[model samples]
Target: MSATGHDYAITRTLDAPVEKVWAAWTDTESYGRWASAEEVVLDVRPGGAWSSVMVIPGGARIPLTGSYTEVVPNERLVMGMNVPGRDEPVLMALDLTPDGDRTKITLSQTFDRAEDRDQSEQGSNMLLDGLTRFLAAA
Candidate 1:
């Protein structure tokens, strides 16, 4: 559970090293391999920008853009995620911790309304699942 003022939070433990999991989130090519996105551009530094085009199952493409507010290598990442046609960007925080030979990842997304967070829950979990599988195969 996260007390980061987020509307939604999900946690997953990956059977991969912390450094490997960290790279999966921060590196462009690694992220593209695991993320549910058609294309990804990640500049993983504070104030750096990142963007991705999420390909929905039914061929819908949603463009997402964000800027990193905080980036602590292999530990935490905070970003402002821009929603399509929305002026205010949602805040997202990702925290990583080492657990033996594995990594524990907690992802939190803050939205204005509970409905919005509910709507995003499934996709967010799917994203983490995808990461888990990717890491397992790596």
Candidate 2:
């Protein structure tokens, strides 16, 4: 998919079929494995709720809550994430497209400030890296 004027966009190609990639993304058990979350609760449907306690570096646990604004099975997912101390929720869109035997994934996040976009890039990359490893193992 093309850019959607999101503040931050990260693209990755996973060495897995579109079906496997989509399952890893939408399934709470698979997602928690890739995300390294302490806990995860995902209701994968439009208007559903999702939350995760991410265990970042130094053993710090960051709680993130979000609601799904859109869900289109293996094609697309849009969620609004509520992070602590943030006045507005960050909107994130996950798009998946099949590329032969593999899958191309785009993660686009919309933030209100440029600093927020810049600050999130590293963490996003780390998450993608984790996902790649997770898929490789699977």
Candidate 3:
């Protein structure tokens, strides 16, 4: 759980090693492959930029922009996403722990509104599913 009020928190263990999971989160191509987003542009260092243009199944498009607020190599990441009409940025933190050969990932997201937080939780699940599939195929 985050220090702030985190509306969504997910803990998942991936079969892959910490190195692979960390690469997936930090590398643009790997991230794009499993992020359920298109045209992803990632600059992974602290204070760097990240953005993704999402394309829905029905042809709807949503663009997301954000920056990496903090980076701790393979262990953790802190970031915030920018929403057009929102006053405050949606914050997210990801922590990775190596468990044997697998990696345990905990994700926390804080949203200003409950509704938005609920919606984002579903998307977060989908993103984790995508990452699972991506690892399976590897």
lDDT of 1 by residue, 1-138 (tens): 235432877988889989999999988888887887867989889999999998878888889898999999999999898877798778778999999999999998766666777777777888898899999898
Q: Give candidate 2 misplaced runs (Cα > 4 Å).
A: 1-6, 85-87
Q: Can you give the lDDT of residue 113 in candidate 3? A: 63
What TM-score does candidate 2 get on C-alpha atoms?
Answer: 0.90
After superposition, which runs of candidate 3 have C-alpha atoms over 4 Å from their true positions? 1-6
Q: TM-score for model 1?
A: 0.90
lDDT of 3 by residue, 20-44 (tens): 9989988888888887678888888
User: What is candidate 2's CA lDDT for residue 100?
Assistant: 88
lDDT of 2: 0.86
C-alpha positional error of residue 10 in candidate 1 after TM-score superposition, expressed in Å: 1.0
Clashing residue pairs in candidate 1 are none
**Cα RMSD (angstroms) for every candidate in the order listed:** 2.4, 2.8, 2.0
How close is every model to the real structure, measured as TM-score?
0.90, 0.90, 0.91
